[model samples]
Target: MDRSLDQLRRRLLIHCTPSQAHTAAEIATAHDTGLVVTGASADTIAHRLREKGFDGPILCDADRYSGPRRVDGGRGIRPAWCRRQQELGLVPLTDSGYLEPDNWNALRSILRVAALQRRPVIAMLPLAARWFAESHAVDDLARELDSYGVAVAVAIEHASDPFSVQYVVRHFLRLLRTAQVPVLLLRSDVAALGALCHGAFAAATGTTSSLRHIYPLTSKGIPRAAFPAVFIRHLLSYHRLDTCETVFARTPETSHFWLCDCVVCGGTTPDRLHDSDDQYSVALRHSLHAQLLLHDEIFRHTDTPDQRASAWHEACSHALFVHRQVAEHVPDWRTPAHLKSWHTVTDDPLRGRAGIPAQPTQRSVLFERPAEKWSAHERRGV
Candidate 1:
């Protein structure tokens, strides 16, 4: 229940949907992972997780931004609801609507409302990938965010395309460099690892694809995929379990590279991932554990920015090579664009090599609290 700033920093926050609550709770018993729940299920889910031995930081996200074109109808998110979330021993959030290029006024209103909370509130800034990464007003947005002096987490909604994924990582690194405040990446899957290596304080990803990326919602309903994909840790991306099964079935010799030795898998082969009724849950757990492993690798070299960037760069380079080996066997399978994009972004010589001080330390980016000052609220779980 000691949710201090030090406890929150350098953690791979797992965003759990209602369905993923129990599985996440089970994992919480062993791993030092943070839990992020939606506003509707914050209190009940937090209590459930606590009963199951999840003693890490719990954050409530105000799920107001569904897509770039969608706007809050003014009824879904209320200030009183946010205050109630804070009162429930969970970190509250600002009800920020999706911001476009011309929606600076809306951002101002969101910040103003967050300022009224009188506590540490996470301000959500959701925007289209291109607008967030390629727009000229990125510095303006950063200035406004710094001026407000609040913890802001940004999500690049609907960044399924390759170009957007490439720039989103670049833009996140740029914002983290220029912004005076903490710039946390939210709802990112593998991109979260890149953000942390480039000097982000915190990053989050969802258990399922629907929770991982933000897409447009329709009047009919939100589109949900039928099955969870397998997370190939060496490749740093998710692949279809069926596809993995085929690959292992066709080319059994390559099984050595794709097999997972995590506690959930216990050295199980990739083809056996779909062998049980709880296949979806298995895949979800494997993905979470794989991501946490990647996060640990990046944080292991946090002593210097060069070492951190070099560590991630080496991972990406090896992933790309593995993709080539996989393609030679499974001719139909191709490497995901984001993997290539991440490698390319880090390949820049100026990224983590030059013009940066050696003594400041990446530890400075984290928000640390004195143990004595936060002792009173430790029992409250905030």
Candidate 2:
């Protein structure tokens, strides 16, 4: 790998929409962070970033997997767009078809195109959940991808259920173990951190929920909320601004868990997150910084793969404990199902072998809420 790609390892690639590009550039200028933008905004965003003095690596998502017809939408892959990507200093992604259980032809065609290009090109493979449930398909795909010697970007369709995502993650790790090529997990949320822990070359999460995952476009447009969700690191999930305020208001003493000390937050607590014309920008910067802090913690643990996995598992377990403790006080703040699913998978003994795991655990923890029992400094340590 070259110096630019090398810098991407163990780092969170912030996926920015056209509107968020300026903020991301400001943040990227200070940190060794890579920015991902769609092909539509690639040239403009890259130009703006360069003008703003950010010369780091920029990735352009071809975004060809959403529709069936290649030329149906302007966002789909085209020769002109690919050339534009090259001009903007990006490793062009092929206009690969979305991969389903029976879509071996599409996968093979992408690899063949990568070989013909004779340059470093990322083969973006948008997968369906069925790819994970079918082990034979995953093995075949991984073998073919490894032989091509081209970097791969894997994007899964939106899945509301954790089981659906778990399948994708398990198969993703299998590919990482088998393939020598770099693999990137795109359009993710908290799952991005889990991917980095288990050896993903890079992972991306959007500033808003809609961009966080790949959703099939419907005739009926999905409505986006006025204010984006706030990322609470302690809970390992995103919550609405109103939800955060409610949690803090109900259990004022326990607000320490959600308070952020990142550069964006300074000394301000999450309880003060309210809707304003500028609240979205504040949430976006805070979310990005909070994720960076957690990513740093994971990367700082210089140990073997098993040890890293153990550390991540411990963090998830502690987050779950915090969730339960908060629920004990705030009735409406129940733990999200995906959080429980993440902890369960990390706790499996087989997690060491595959780097990711399946199977669920029924274990439960009973602990007294620590707000009253611990000092402010001690509580911060938790």
- Candidate 1 versus the native: TM-score? 0.83
* lDDT tens readout by residue for model 2, 234-334: 78888878888777777666655655665655445654656445677677877876786677655664356675666667667767887887788777666
Candidate 1: residue 374 lDDT (0-100): 22
The deviation in Å at residue 171 for candidate 1 is 1.4
User: In candidate 2, which residue pairs clash?
Assistant: none
lDDT score at residue 76, model 2, on the 0-100 scale: 29
**lDDT (Cα) of model 1:** 0.66
lDDT of 1 at 47: 72
List TM-score per model, in order: 0.83, 0.83
Model 2: what TM-score? 0.83
Candidate 1 lDDT, 45-161, residue by residue in tens: 777776776777777665677743456533223577567666666666665767655566777777767767756666777766655556456777788888888777777767353
RMSD of each: 8.3, 7.6
